[model samples]
Target: MPLILFNKPFQVLCQFSPQEGRQSLADYLSIPGIYPAGRLDADSEGLMLLTDDGALQHKIAHPDHKEAKTYLVQVDGIPDAASLARLQAPIDLGDFVTKPCRAVRIAEPEWLWPRNPPIRTRADKPTGWIAITLEEGKNRQVRRMTAAVGLPTLRLVRSSIGPFSLATHPLMPGEFVEIPVAALKSKR
Candidate 1:
């Protein structure tokens, strides 16, 4: 069994299968039977783990497992303390209420690469960064949560899932490194 760590670039789909003309993992990864353990939105970027083992994949991606999935989010406005509090609170999203998540203001990551098409800059409206960690992988949850708190996310990048990290693994966009499946299974 093989476990692979990939630095998924922005605009890439999480699946290996092709989706029309949009970029997919197949554009970067060629190995067979190594499906993504979890999903990252097409507009988002960062660490995405792939594995051949079903059990290991479930452990990392399952919502009930409550694995900490951390995102480095760039938002439009600097959220005040009250807005930050609202983010940590379990706000209702009409259909479902989000689980209480940890959201803390963080400096823009110095290690981050500029997006291919840079985020729109507004000299008048300042932007800031926040680290938001969630246990559930709901569709567009991070972006919705920030928006609910009046901080619209301009760019989002998932930095880690559980103990695995893009920094520790060290792969650039479109690059990946293989790890032993047994090693990944032992990690959590």
Candidate 2:
């Protein structure tokens, strides 16, 4: 089984599926027989995994497997501890309550890369960053979580998943690398 680490960029779809007027993984990844282990929304950017092994894919994608996925989020407002506490606690999204999540304010990284279509900035508004890690994957969870806490997410990026990291891989938008079966197996 082969597993690859990818640094998915903003507005890049995670899957190879075709969209009417949107970009997808097909535009970037050309490795035959490879598929994303999980998905990141086109509006979100960060670490994405691709693999040829069904079991390994399932392990990484299934919420029950509880593989931690960490994200660096720039939000519309400064998040106070009380607000962050609300995030760490479970959130009821009507359909279901989200699993416990970890969130904390973080200083802006000096090395953070700029987005191609940069996040909107307002002259009269101030914003901050938060680092959140969750075991369960959900639709726009971080964005939704922040919104629920009164701080809407302006930009979202996945920095790491399990032991794989975007910092080490350092792929620009529309780039990918294939990890050999031996390395994938050795990771365990």
Candidate 3:
């Protein structure tokens, strides 16, 4: 079985299926039978895992497995200590309350690739970055969580999932690499 790590670009739909005016995984990947183990929103960018094995997909995507996913998030304003604390703790997002996760302010990653269509900026209001880790991913959960703290997300990027990371396996947008399934046992 092949496990693929793809650097999904911003505004590309997560699905392999066509979506009219938008790009999808199919636009970048043509491998037969491989499907995304988990989803990253179209507005977001970065690492995505695709595999042909059903069990491996389940383990990576299912909330019960508790695989950690980390994101480098850019928000509209600098987060105060209180806001960072709120992000680390669980918060009710109406649809569901997120689990307590790690959240900390981080310098903008030097390895990050710029989005094709850059995020809108405000000269007067400064933006900040945070590295947030979560075990369970829900629909737009990170964006919603940041919004709850009054810092709307400007750009979101998934840097890692479980034992794989973009830092270790760097790729430009729309590029992908194949790795042995055994690599999943390596340290996160």
Candidate 4:
């Protein structure tokens, strides 16, 4: 199996096709036949897995598979105990209710790379970091979850997916590394 772990940069579209004014996966990866197992919105950044094998892609991306994805988020305000509890519990996102997941405050990761064109800062407001792990992903779910609890997400980075982590296999934005299929044995 051909599998690639890519650190997607902010504002890069997740698809392989060309977009008129936006950067897409085609801009960085020339490997043919490999498709993104899942997607990260243009505004978000972080780890993405690509594979040529359809079954592998499904196993990684499908919600039913329950592979945990961890994200490091910078939000506009410091969350108190109530907010943290709310985040870890099932909460209705209007269209659907999120599954209970782990959510905790964290200091900014030392190994994080700076985002290009950085997020805005204000003298009047404070920002805080939180690490959230979710088993099921929804479109803009992290941003929504934070907003629902009165903390607006300013930066979002998916730091890890299942056994593959940026900490263990680090890559700068637009860089990717291929690992053997055996690396996935832990998941089985």
Candidate 5:
């Protein structure tokens, strides 16, 4: 089975279907039968894995597997130690409480490409980057968690999933690489 690692671009939909104006995986990938393992919102940009193997897809996407998904987030405020700790602590988002995860401040990744429509920043207020790795992905979990911790997210990017990293692959937005299913599962 073919396992594809794609660097999804900003404003691109995670699905393969065509929409009236939104761009989808079909625009970057034409290889039939491969489906996205999980979702990254259209506003978010970075690594996304696609595969034809159903079991592998389930392992990668399902929260039950507890496969870590790492993100590079730009938040509205300069997150302090207290705020960063709050990110790693269990927090409520009304519908559900988030699982404990890694959250740390990081220098802006120099290798990261610029988004098409750049993130808005305030002249008076400062913005900073934080790397957050979560095993469970709720609907807009990163955004919600950051906001709850008093650090509103401005831009969010999934830089890695399990053993697959956008850094190691180094694919530009819309670029992809094919890999063996065994290679990925073995990394687990």
Candidate 6:
């Protein structure tokens, strides 16, 4: 079994588990034997990894592996350099200090599609985007980190994991593509 890289669209659940009238991996992925290596919450969207190799799945999803995951986050407030630096710097998240990461302000991305159940818009407020990369993925880590810095996330998208990039292998909502196992293990 190889890997299937997916650009999971918004409002899509990351598992095969059925919910009452809810979308799940079963709806998008028809490839048998493959399962999501990790998960993207229904409200969040972006790169999702699917594979049948249990060892490879563990390598990608294990927090201890420190595999870098990158996200493009739209936040309710514009962040200044100091705030961006704070995100790049480590902060004690109570349980642990996050591994040092990279956070930079970026222009609104043009490559994104309109999200289903779009993020709420405030008539009087503005939003901005930031690119953040983390080696450690905790539960809703990016969302929590942005909130911790006073800039709550309005939308979050995981753009890449290690060498896999969603931009290269685009997935319309409810579609999938497959990659051979050896190909997934190759250097980009």
Q: TM-score: which candidate is best?
A: 4
Clashes (N, CA, C under 3 Å) per candidate: 0, 0, 0, 0, 0, 1
Q: Give the alpha-carbon lDDT of every model.
A: 0.89, 0.85, 0.94, 0.94, 0.93, 0.85
Candidate 4: C-alpha RMSD to true structure equals: 0.9
In candidate 1 the C-alpha lDDT for residue 153 amounts to 96
lDDT of 1 by residue, 134-185 (tens): 8887999999999998999999999898888887887678889898756766
What is candidate 4's lDDT per residue for 78-104, written digit by digit as tens? 988899999999989999999999999
TM-score of 5: 0.97
Return the lDDT, model 3, position 104.
95
Model 1 superposed RMSD (Cα): 1.2
lDDT of model number 1: 0.89
Q: For residues 76-182, could you state the per-residue lDDT of candidate 2 as single tens digits? A: 98989899999999999777799888999998766578998988889888999999999998888888899988999998889888877777777776667777777
Give the per-residue lDDT digits (tens) of candidate 6, residues 1-188: 76888878787788888888887888777778988888887888889888898988999899888778999999999999998999999977777788799999999888887787788998898899999999888888888899999999999999889887777777665556777767765743
For 1-188, candidate 3 gives per-residue lDDT tens digits of 89999999999999988989999999999999999999999999999999999998999899999999999999999988999999999899998899999999999999899888988887999999999999999999999999999999999999999988999999999999999757655543
Give residue 117's error in model 2 in angstroms: 0.9
Output the better candidate (2/3) by TM-score: 3
TM-scores of the models, in the order given: 0.96, 0.94, 0.97, 0.98, 0.97, 0.93
The weakest ten consecutive residues by lDDT in model 2 span 167-176
True-structure RMSD, every candidate: 1.2, 1.4, 1.3, 0.9, 1.0, 1.5
TM-score-better candidate, 1 vs 3: 3
